[model samples]
Target chain A: AQSVTQPDIHITVSEGASLELRCNYSYGATPYLFWYVQSPGQGLQLLLKYFSGDTLVQGIKGFEAEFKRSQSSFNLRKPSVHWSDAAEYFCAVALYGGATNKLIFGTGTLLAVQP
Target chain B: EPEVTQTPSHQVTQMGQEVILRCVPISNHLYFYWYRQILGQKVEFLVSFYNNEISEKSEIFDDQFSVERPDGSNFTLKIRSTKLEDSAMYFCASRAKNIQYFGAGTRLSVL
Candidate 1:
């Protein structure tokens, strides 16, 4: 079975400050990794994804994530955070070639940006 | 960019009543999925449909839950009897390959 873990339950950062959210996963093999953001009362939005080649993957909203195979981590980073960026972030993993494209998601981290 | 679309942005149903949540996946996508997120909880997978049949489903998709691709464009989840615990946001997704696109979701509130 595959599982994802996000260590931080909530993080508060000042606006314009750098932001990083930690994510770790346990899978039998290299899996398809993804980061998604959900605003209050909004649906899940794709932030970034890691599949094969590049360790550093860039996504929408000026966000990016690095896939570290050795540490089993894919951490999301942004140089500057905005008030609108405050939302819940989730990290997920899915089997590469599995018949069912089911994603296992982490508990999630709530991001709060302070002015 | 292509995106998935779900209907009934919000739904309120009484306990023991039936509710149907609908979705329209991206036109070219082949795989369809249904997921639910309970308030303050992580998103959970409910079922996956492919080739007009269910390829996989989670334990949460019990007898009370059912999915159907009745037409060329619509995919629906029917809950036989709603429960208070069923109050949550139900998201519909579709995948062409590895990346799955999601809809805004239908927030179902069972009272």
Candidate 2:
């Protein structure tokens, strides 16, 4: 079965420091990958997505993710973390040729930014 | 920027009571979906709706659950008999293409 895995359950980063959240996926074919961030009392916001082109995809809030096919990974990274960036991040995958494009999401990584 | 909207940010219900979660998807979107996340678990897909019919559903969406696009603007998920294990955050999403937009979920607490 296709699934997504986010290894880091919780991560703490100092404000202004760089950050990286790891993600791995298992699927038969090349699946569409995405990263979403959810703040308390808010909906999941699209951070970035990896489709057919460009290994590195840049998204809102200065977030970027790199999709590595050989490693079966799509990791999200940010050069500088902000206090407002403290939130839960989820990595999701959708099959390429599936009839109904239902998303398979990984257990999220909760990031806490320290001032 | 269009978005999907869900109602009743939080709901509390007794076991065996019926509960309906509501959503209003982006007007032009063609696909709709329901997903749930347990307190500390990954978000799981419950069902997908398109063209007023269910395109797909997961095992978690058993006979107790049903979905409807009542009036072209609103989509609803009804649980015939709520169970204690049904407590979770339910999310509504809509898609026009490859990207799916999510709404602020409704946290259901079944006591």
Candidate 3:
């Protein structure tokens, strides 16, 4: 079965600093990868996704992720972190060509921004 | 931008009682999905519905759980007998193509 792993349980970063949230997936073949963010008392919002094109995919709110096939990683990156960026980040994956492409999500990394 | 909407932001139900969570997916979306997250756990897939029928479901969706699309817009999940362990944040999502939009989730608390 396909599974996603977010090794970091919590990460605290100072405001205006760069940030990277690590994600790794285990699957038989290349899968569609996605990054989502959830604010407190809010739903999950799509950050970015990697289907088949470029390795680097840009998303809303100054977020981006790179899909590295060799490492089975699709790590999210932000050049500068802001207070509003603090949230729980999840990495999810789904198989290709399925009638019902259910997402398999990682445990998520809680991001805290310190001013 | 279109979005999914779930009703009754929070639901408090007694154990062994029945509870129904409702959702209204995007009007143009063809695929509807239900997912849940335990307090500190990862978001887990519960079931997926398309063409007015369930196309896939996870092991967590057992005899006590059921889904229905009673009308063109309303999609609902019914728990026959709620258990304390069923307390979680249930999210409803709809997919137009590949990307899925999630609702603000309904927090179900079984006591």
Docking class of 2: high
Q: At residue B43, give the lDDT of candidate 1.
A: 92
**Model 2 ranges with Cα > 4 A deviation:** none
> What C-alpha lDDT, on a 0 to 100 scale, does residue A36 get in candidate 1?
94
Provide the TM-score for each candidate, comma-separated: 0.97, 0.98, 0.99
- In model 1, residue pairs whose N, Cα or C atoms come closer than 3 Å (at least 3 residues apart or on different chains), thus clashing, are none
- Largest DockQ belongs to which candidate? 3
| Regions of model 1 farther than 4 Å from truth | none
Worst 10 residues of 3 chain A by lDDT: A94-103
lDDT of 1 by residue, B29-104 (tens): 8899999999889899999989999999999999999999999999999999999999999999999768898999
TM-score (chain B) of candidate 1: 0.98
Query: What TM-score would you report for chain A in candidate 2?
Result: 0.97
Q: For model 2, what share of native contacts is present?
A: 0.79
C-alpha local distance difference test of each model? 0.94, 0.95, 0.95
True contacts kept of each: 0.74, 0.79, 0.90
Q: For residues A47-112, could you state the per-residue lDDT of candidate 2 as single tens digits?
A: 999988899999999999999999999999999999999999999999745557999999999999
